[model samples]
Target: MFEDGQVVPRAVLDSLLCDAAISRYIFGPDSQLINIGRTERIYPDELRRAIIARDTHCQYPGCTAPPRLCEAHHTKHWGRDHGTTDATTGVLLCWHHHIHVHTHDIDITWKTHPTETSTEKHGKRSRKNAPTGHWEFTDRNGNLIQ
Candidate 1:
């Protein structure tokens, strides 16, 4: 699932999906999140793996919640900001911190690749978010969250 590593077994990826570790996320060369059709709040499989790979644990900085328990959270609320279901717009947050993030107005910023070109067709429902590369956290005041 990574750009510079050995291929993850499809079985592992399937298991992660069953465990709900995959959420809205990234993808590899054969496919990209920018090319998937998104349903209202449901993540396509590729997106899910991308998120699981991006965050091996709850992405709340100090939280150690396992990936299987995390749900995809939009750094920008989907309804409120028209957030896309892509890694650049998503973060993995466990149940507790997920609630906290929303209530506290924390901000998650992802590093992205705006110039990367892809041959896949962009989904009509997909937001035009740049593909996420890496990420950082911040608070409402723009100070680092951790």
Candidate 2:
């Protein structure tokens, strides 16, 4: 049921569950209603910030939309794949690309790089390396996007 109390189909509910705030309902004995908790964000602030820092911009190929204009997208969907809501499984995508990805069923594969310590002699920073992780996009047909 919606806030307007209009009953909808399960498909509508499933779609909302995929990328919406969720409220965990607690129960009591005798199946009595107990508590209705506040809705929780799909991606928490810290994890979202980490993903934004790592991505820096939209991960959809040449798109350069900054983190401010992007949203955290789950490479492995939480509802579909039971994916974890962590930096390792998230990426930054602009609104257009984010919607495009989900609409067209684009696949995202995340590859992680090990943390490398600087080998500099003094306290100077070393040359910057790749990000902690990266993602590759593929179409539904399994063809990689350039």
Candidate 3:
């Protein structure tokens, strides 16, 4: 699903639905949870296209990875009960960096800074927020990269 660059087919979706139904029938209603609302609107095709165009690659600084290996990350996680799902609260990140951003207490700041030419540069930067139990990424030369 990640490599083919194709939308999920209906047959596979049907099979998944059947499996879930069988599980629910055997285990009981509490075994399955259903989401019936506008949550799916957040992952529309246009949003994916916008993510690709805006970020171009992984938004993690110094990472040259492409979009195919990355995911559109929501800065504010979406929940069934929570109401916010705006475009500004999203970023693109590769799998490793995405997990790192969520699992650790990392501070991510999205702002505009002045460039050498005195022009504004807008982007996101990560800083370690925890005193301990924090994750770090380093380059091959044993220097910290993130």
Clashes of each: 3, 0, 0
Q: So what's the TM-score on candidate 1? A: 0.59
- Model 3 C-alpha lDDT per residue in residues 2-101, reported as the tens digit of each score: 3778876543432232112111111125642232123342444455566677678887767868989987665544432232333344567787777665
lDDT of each: 0.64, 0.71, 0.49
* All candidates: TM-score: 0.59, 0.63, 0.47
Off by over 4 Å in 1: 1-39, 111-134
Error of 2 at 19 (Å): 3.1
Residue-wise lDDT of candidate 1 within 1-146, one digit each (tens)? 66878796643443233223223334467756542323435566666678888788898888989978888776655544555556657688897787677667677887566654444456544335456465678887889877
Q: Identify the leading candidate in terms of lDDT.
A: 2
**Given candidate 2, what's the lDDT at residue 22?**
59
**Which candidate model has the greater TM-score, 1 or 2?**
2
The TM-score of candidate 2 is 0.63
Q: In angstroms, how far off is 19's CA in candidate 1?
A: 17
Per-model RMSD to reference: 16.3, 9.4, 15.4
Query: Per-residue lDDT of 1-146 in model 2, one digit per residue for the tens?
Result: 87899996644443355577754444456553333233333766655766777789999998999888988877766666655555666789998888778777888998678776666657777865545756889998999997
